[model samples]
Target: MPYTLIKSSNPEDFVLVHRFLMQAIQRLRAAGIPLWEPEDVSVDALVKAYGTHSLYLVMDNEKTIGGVFVLEEDALFWPEIVTNDSFFFHKLVIGDDFITKGIGHRVLDALVELAKSHGKHWLRCDCHGDRPRLRNFYESFGFYFIDRKTVEGFDAARYEYPCL
Candidate 1:
Protein backbone atom coordinates (compact mmCIF):
# COMPACT_ATOMS: atom_id res chain seq x y z
CA MET A 1 0.00 0.00 0.00
CA PRO A 2 1.18 3.53 -0.81
CA TYR A 3 1.41 6.23 1.87
CA THR A 4 1.50 9.99 2.12
CA LEU A 5 2.83 12.33 4.80
CA ILE A 6 0.81 15.42 5.46
CA LYS A 7 1.04 18.35 7.82
CA SER A 8 -2.06 19.27 9.87
CA SER A 9 -3.25 22.28 7.93
CA ASN A 10 -7.01 21.82 7.99
CA PRO A 11 -9.32 21.51 10.98
CA GLU A 12 -11.27 18.51 9.70
CA ASP A 13 -8.12 16.48 9.21
CA PHE A 14 -6.93 17.32 12.72
CA VAL A 15 -10.16 15.85 14.11
CA LEU A 16 -9.14 12.54 12.62
CA VAL A 17 -5.62 13.23 13.80
CA HIS A 18 -6.97 13.40 17.36
CA ARG A 19 -8.78 10.08 16.96
CA PHE A 20 -5.63 8.66 15.42
CA LEU A 21 -3.68 9.68 18.52
CA MET A 22 -6.23 8.24 20.95
CA GLN A 23 -6.15 4.90 19.19
CA ALA A 24 -2.38 4.90 19.16
CA ILE A 25 -2.31 5.47 22.90
CA GLN A 26 -4.70 2.59 23.36
CA ARG A 27 -2.57 0.36 21.18
CA LEU A 28 0.60 1.20 23.08
CA ARG A 29 -1.11 0.48 26.36
CA ALA A 30 -2.14 -2.90 25.01
CA ALA A 31 1.51 -3.55 24.13
CA GLY A 32 2.57 -2.58 27.69
CA ILE A 33 4.32 0.64 26.72
CA PRO A 34 4.23 3.46 29.25
CA LEU A 35 2.21 6.38 27.97
CA TRP A 36 2.00 9.60 29.96
CA GLU A 37 -1.22 11.17 28.87
CA PRO A 38 -4.56 9.57 29.55
CA GLU A 39 -6.18 8.14 26.44
CA ASP A 40 -9.05 10.55 26.99
CA VAL A 41 -7.06 13.51 25.71
CA SER A 42 -9.66 15.45 23.79
CA VAL A 43 -9.41 16.17 20.10
CA ASP A 44 -10.64 19.71 20.46
CA ALA A 45 -8.05 20.37 23.14
CA LEU A 46 -5.28 18.91 21.02
CA VAL A 47 -6.24 20.97 18.02
CA LYS A 48 -6.57 24.08 20.12
CA ALA A 49 -3.32 23.61 22.00
CA TYR A 50 -1.07 22.49 19.15
CA GLY A 51 -2.30 24.87 16.52
CA THR A 52 -1.18 23.62 13.10
CA HIS A 53 2.52 22.85 12.70
CA SER A 54 3.09 20.46 15.59
CA LEU A 55 0.75 17.74 14.28
CA TYR A 56 1.47 15.23 11.53
CA LEU A 57 -0.16 12.15 10.08
CA VAL A 58 0.88 9.29 7.83
CA MET A 59 -1.91 8.05 5.63
CA ASP A 60 -2.56 5.28 3.17
CA ASN A 61 -5.66 5.91 1.07
CA GLU A 62 -6.76 8.63 3.49
CA LYS A 63 -6.61 6.29 6.45
CA THR A 64 -4.32 7.51 9.23
CA ILE A 65 -2.17 4.68 10.50
CA GLY A 66 0.43 6.80 12.30
CA GLY A 67 0.76 10.22 13.80
CA VAL A 68 3.15 12.41 15.82
CA PHE A 69 3.52 15.75 17.51
CA VAL A 70 6.52 18.07 17.33
CA LEU A 71 7.13 20.73 19.89
CA GLU A 72 9.72 23.41 20.45
CA GLU A 73 10.05 22.31 24.06
CA ASP A 74 7.87 21.14 26.96
CA ALA A 75 5.84 18.34 25.46
CA LEU A 76 3.16 16.68 27.63
CA PHE A 77 5.36 13.67 28.25
CA TRP A 78 8.49 15.78 28.56
CA PRO A 79 7.82 18.59 30.98
CA GLU A 80 11.40 19.47 31.84
CA ILE A 81 12.86 22.66 30.51
CA VAL A 82 15.29 22.11 27.66
CA THR A 83 17.60 24.81 26.41
CA ASN A 84 17.75 26.30 22.95
CA ASP A 85 18.62 25.01 19.47
CA SER A 86 16.62 21.79 19.46
CA PHE A 87 13.20 20.89 18.13
CA PHE A 88 11.49 18.35 20.35
CA PHE A 89 8.98 15.54 19.79
CA HIS A 90 6.45 13.62 21.86
CA LYS A 91 3.49 11.26 21.46
CA LEU A 92 4.61 9.33 18.39
CA VAL A 93 2.50 6.31 17.52
CA ILE A 94 2.81 3.93 14.60
CA GLY A 95 0.18 1.26 14.10
CA ASP A 96 0.88 -2.49 14.07
CA ASP A 97 0.36 -2.57 10.33
CA PHE A 98 2.83 0.27 9.92
CA ILE A 99 5.58 -1.27 12.06
CA THR A 100 9.00 -2.16 10.55
CA LYS A 101 7.85 -0.94 7.15
CA GLY A 102 10.15 2.10 7.51
CA ILE A 103 7.34 4.48 8.48
CA GLY A 104 9.00 5.53 11.72
CA HIS A 105 12.29 6.16 10.02
CA ARG A 106 10.54 8.02 7.24
CA VAL A 107 8.75 10.26 9.72
CA LEU A 108 11.94 10.87 11.65
CA ASP A 109 13.73 11.84 8.49
CA ALA A 110 10.83 14.01 7.48
CA LEU A 111 10.80 15.77 10.86
CA VAL A 112 14.53 16.30 10.71
CA GLU A 113 14.18 17.67 7.21
CA LEU A 114 11.35 19.87 8.32
CA ALA A 115 13.43 21.18 11.21
CA LYS A 116 16.40 21.74 8.90
CA SER A 117 14.19 23.77 6.63
CA HIS A 118 13.68 26.10 9.58
CA GLY A 119 17.47 26.13 10.31
CA LYS A 120 17.15 24.05 13.45
CA HIS A 121 20.23 22.13 14.62
CA TRP A 122 18.88 19.20 16.60
CA LEU A 123 15.89 16.92 17.04
CA ARG A 124 15.24 15.73 20.57
CA CYS A 125 12.83 13.25 22.17
CA ASP A 126 12.20 11.36 25.39
CA CYS A 127 11.50 7.67 25.80
CA HIS A 128 11.17 4.99 28.42
CA GLY A 129 14.74 4.11 29.39
CA ASP A 130 14.20 0.42 30.03
CA ARG A 131 12.55 -0.39 26.73
CA PRO A 132 15.42 -1.86 24.79
CA ARG A 133 13.49 -2.14 21.55
CA LEU A 134 12.45 1.50 21.60
CA ARG A 135 15.88 2.69 22.72
CA ASN A 136 17.68 0.69 20.06
CA PHE A 137 15.31 1.91 17.40
CA TYR A 138 16.16 5.58 18.02
CA GLU A 139 19.87 4.75 18.24
CA SER A 140 19.69 3.30 14.74
CA PHE A 141 18.54 6.71 13.60
CA GLY A 142 21.73 8.20 15.14
CA PHE A 143 19.94 9.66 18.16
CA TYR A 144 22.28 9.35 21.09
CA PHE A 145 21.28 9.07 24.73
CA ILE A 146 22.09 12.45 26.18
CA ASP A 147 20.45 12.14 29.58
CA ARG A 148 19.52 8.74 30.86
CA LYS A 149 17.45 9.61 33.90
CA THR A 150 13.98 10.31 35.14
CA VAL A 151 12.94 13.82 34.33
CA GLU A 152 10.05 15.59 36.03
CA GLY A 153 9.48 12.39 37.98
CA PHE A 154 8.79 10.45 34.82
CA ASP A 155 10.95 7.39 34.24
CA ALA A 156 12.36 8.45 30.91
CA ALA A 157 15.60 9.23 29.11
CA ARG A 158 16.35 11.95 26.65
CA TYR A 159 17.71 11.25 23.16
CA GLU A 160 18.98 13.65 20.56
CA TYR A 161 20.15 13.52 16.95
CA PRO A 162 21.98 16.25 15.15
CA CYS A 163 20.04 17.68 12.26
CA LEU A 164 22.72 19.97 10.84
Candidate 2:
Protein backbone atom coordinates (compact mmCIF):
# COMPACT_ATOMS: atom_id res chain seq x y z
CA MET A 1 0.00 0.00 0.00
CA PRO A 2 1.17 3.54 -0.76
CA TYR A 3 1.59 5.72 2.29
CA THR A 4 1.76 9.50 2.48
CA LEU A 5 3.83 11.47 4.94
CA ILE A 6 2.30 14.73 6.06
CA LYS A 7 4.52 17.16 7.95
CA SER A 8 2.56 18.08 11.04
CA SER A 9 2.47 21.80 11.97
CA ASN A 10 -0.77 22.63 13.70
CA PRO A 11 -1.93 21.84 17.26
CA GLU A 12 -4.57 19.36 16.11
CA ASP A 13 -2.03 17.30 14.23
CA PHE A 14 0.25 17.34 17.23
CA VAL A 15 -2.53 15.92 19.38
CA LEU A 16 -3.09 13.13 16.93
CA VAL A 17 0.61 12.42 16.80
CA HIS A 18 0.81 12.32 20.58
CA ARG A 19 -2.04 9.81 20.77
CA PHE A 20 -0.43 7.63 18.14
CA LEU A 21 2.87 7.70 19.99
CA MET A 22 1.18 6.85 23.26
CA GLN A 23 -0.55 3.88 21.71
CA ALA A 24 2.77 2.66 20.37
CA ILE A 25 4.32 3.07 23.78
CA GLN A 26 1.57 1.03 25.35
CA ARG A 27 1.98 -1.72 22.83
CA LEU A 28 5.71 -1.84 23.37
CA ARG A 29 5.27 -1.96 27.11
CA ALA A 30 2.76 -4.78 26.81
CA ALA A 31 5.31 -6.67 24.78
CA GLY A 32 7.88 -6.12 27.55
CA ILE A 33 9.76 -3.59 25.48
CA PRO A 34 10.56 -0.57 27.58
CA LEU A 35 11.20 1.65 24.62
CA TRP A 36 9.40 4.85 25.51
CA GLU A 37 8.01 6.48 28.60
CA PRO A 38 4.78 8.41 28.85
CA GLU A 39 6.57 11.68 29.28
CA ASP A 40 8.58 11.01 26.18
CA VAL A 41 5.44 11.17 24.06
CA SER A 42 3.65 13.95 25.82
CA VAL A 43 2.06 16.74 23.83
CA ASP A 44 4.51 19.27 25.19
CA ALA A 45 7.42 17.11 24.14
CA LEU A 46 6.02 16.78 20.65
CA VAL A 47 5.54 20.51 20.47
CA LYS A 48 9.10 21.10 21.61
CA ALA A 49 10.37 18.72 18.98
CA TYR A 50 8.96 20.99 16.26
CA GLY A 51 11.77 23.44 16.90
CA THR A 52 14.46 20.83 16.18
CA HIS A 53 12.73 18.03 14.31
CA SER A 54 10.17 17.44 11.61
CA LEU A 55 7.13 15.51 12.80
CA TYR A 56 5.26 13.56 10.14
CA LEU A 57 1.97 11.73 10.24
CA VAL A 58 1.99 8.55 8.19
CA MET A 59 -1.18 8.20 6.21
CA ASP A 60 -2.65 5.38 4.18
CA ASN A 61 -4.95 7.18 1.81
CA GLU A 62 -7.27 9.21 4.03
CA LYS A 63 -6.54 7.29 7.21
CA THR A 64 -3.79 8.24 9.64
CA ILE A 65 -1.94 5.11 10.65
CA GLY A 66 1.22 6.30 12.37
CA GLY A 67 3.81 9.02 12.92
CA VAL A 68 7.56 9.58 12.69
CA PHE A 69 10.07 12.22 13.59
CA VAL A 70 12.88 13.14 11.23
CA LEU A 71 15.93 15.03 12.26
CA GLU A 72 18.78 16.48 10.24
CA GLU A 73 21.19 15.88 13.09
CA ASP A 74 21.01 13.56 16.09
CA ALA A 75 23.76 14.68 18.40
CA LEU A 76 22.34 12.68 21.28
CA PHE A 77 22.70 9.29 19.61
CA TRP A 78 25.41 10.01 17.05
CA PRO A 79 27.76 12.38 18.78
CA GLU A 80 30.76 10.58 17.34
CA ILE A 81 29.74 11.57 13.83
CA VAL A 82 29.81 15.24 12.86
CA THR A 83 28.45 15.24 9.35
CA ASN A 84 25.23 16.58 7.86
CA ASP A 85 24.89 13.92 5.17
CA SER A 86 22.50 11.89 7.24
CA PHE A 87 18.79 11.96 8.07
CA PHE A 88 17.91 10.57 11.46
CA PHE A 89 14.63 8.75 11.94
CA HIS A 90 13.02 8.55 15.36
CA LYS A 91 9.73 7.67 17.00
CA LEU A 92 8.51 5.58 14.09
CA VAL A 93 5.17 4.19 15.22
CA ILE A 94 2.66 2.17 13.26
CA GLY A 95 -0.78 1.45 14.63
CA ASP A 96 -1.50 -1.97 16.12
CA ASP A 97 -3.93 -2.71 13.32
CA PHE A 98 -1.26 -1.85 10.77
CA ILE A 99 1.54 -3.99 12.13
CA THR A 100 2.62 -7.18 10.33
CA LYS A 101 1.11 -5.84 7.13
CA GLY A 102 4.36 -4.70 5.49
CA ILE A 103 3.68 -1.13 6.55
CA GLY A 104 7.01 -0.84 8.32
CA HIS A 105 8.88 -1.82 5.21
CA ARG A 106 6.89 0.65 3.14
CA VAL A 107 7.57 3.37 5.66
CA LEU A 108 11.29 2.77 5.57
CA ASP A 109 11.28 2.70 1.81
CA ALA A 110 9.49 6.03 1.77
CA LEU A 111 12.00 7.44 4.24
CA VAL A 112 14.85 6.24 2.08
CA GLU A 113 13.40 8.00 -0.92
CA LEU A 114 12.83 11.13 1.10
CA ALA A 115 16.43 11.09 2.28
CA LYS A 116 17.71 10.60 -1.23
CA SER A 117 15.68 13.54 -2.46
CA HIS A 118 17.26 15.69 0.25
CA GLY A 119 20.73 14.65 -0.86
CA LYS A 120 21.31 12.69 2.33
CA HIS A 121 23.91 10.02 1.96
CA TRP A 122 22.75 8.02 4.95
CA LEU A 123 19.64 7.18 6.92
CA ARG A 124 20.37 6.65 10.60
CA CYS A 125 18.22 5.39 13.45
CA ASP A 126 18.45 3.71 16.84
CA CYS A 127 16.37 1.23 18.79
CA HIS A 128 16.48 -0.25 22.25
CA GLY A 129 19.55 -2.49 22.30
CA ASP A 130 17.63 -5.34 23.80
CA ARG A 131 15.11 -5.52 20.99
CA PRO A 132 16.42 -8.16 18.64
CA ARG A 133 13.30 -8.16 16.49
CA LEU A 134 13.61 -4.47 15.78
CA ARG A 135 17.32 -4.77 15.08
CA ASN A 136 16.69 -7.60 12.68
CA PHE A 137 13.94 -5.60 11.01
CA TYR A 138 16.36 -2.77 10.34
CA GLU A 139 19.03 -5.17 9.14
CA SER A 140 16.58 -6.83 6.79
CA PHE A 141 15.73 -3.38 5.43
CA GLY A 142 19.40 -2.93 4.43
CA PHE A 143 20.49 -1.03 7.50
CA TYR A 144 23.80 -2.17 8.95
CA PHE A 145 24.44 -2.23 12.61
CA ILE A 146 26.89 0.38 13.77
CA ASP A 147 27.29 -0.24 17.50
CA ARG A 148 25.54 -0.34 20.84
CA LYS A 149 25.92 2.68 23.06
CA THR A 150 24.32 4.38 26.01
CA VAL A 151 22.42 7.51 25.14
CA GLU A 152 20.24 9.38 27.57
CA GLY A 153 20.55 6.44 30.01
CA PHE A 154 19.21 3.92 27.50
CA ASP A 155 21.21 1.31 25.68
CA ALA A 156 20.66 1.98 21.98
CA ALA A 157 21.55 -0.08 18.98
CA ARG A 158 22.46 2.26 16.17
CA TYR A 159 22.00 1.41 12.52
CA GLU A 160 22.59 3.26 9.30
CA TYR A 161 21.38 2.70 5.75
CA PRO A 162 23.33 4.20 2.90
CA CYS A 163 20.98 6.24 0.74
CA LEU A 164 22.49 4.92 -2.47
Report, for all candidates in order, the number of backbone clashes: 0, 0
For candidate 1, the lDDT comes to: 0.72
TM-score of each: 0.75, 0.92
Evaluate residue 56 in candidate 2 and report its C-alpha lDDT on the 0 to 100 scale.
Answer: 78
lDDT winner: 2
**Per-residue CA lDDT of candidate 2, range 17-125, in tens?**
7787888888878988776778977878766754534887788898888888898888889887798899998888887777766779999988998899899999999
Pairs that collide in candidate 1 are: none
What is candidate 2's TM-score against the reference? 0.92
Q: Tens digits of per-residue lDDT for model 1 on 39-130?
A: 33576667566656788777667677777777787655455656667788776776665566666787788778877877879888888888
Candidate 2 C-alpha error for residue 86, in Å: 0.8
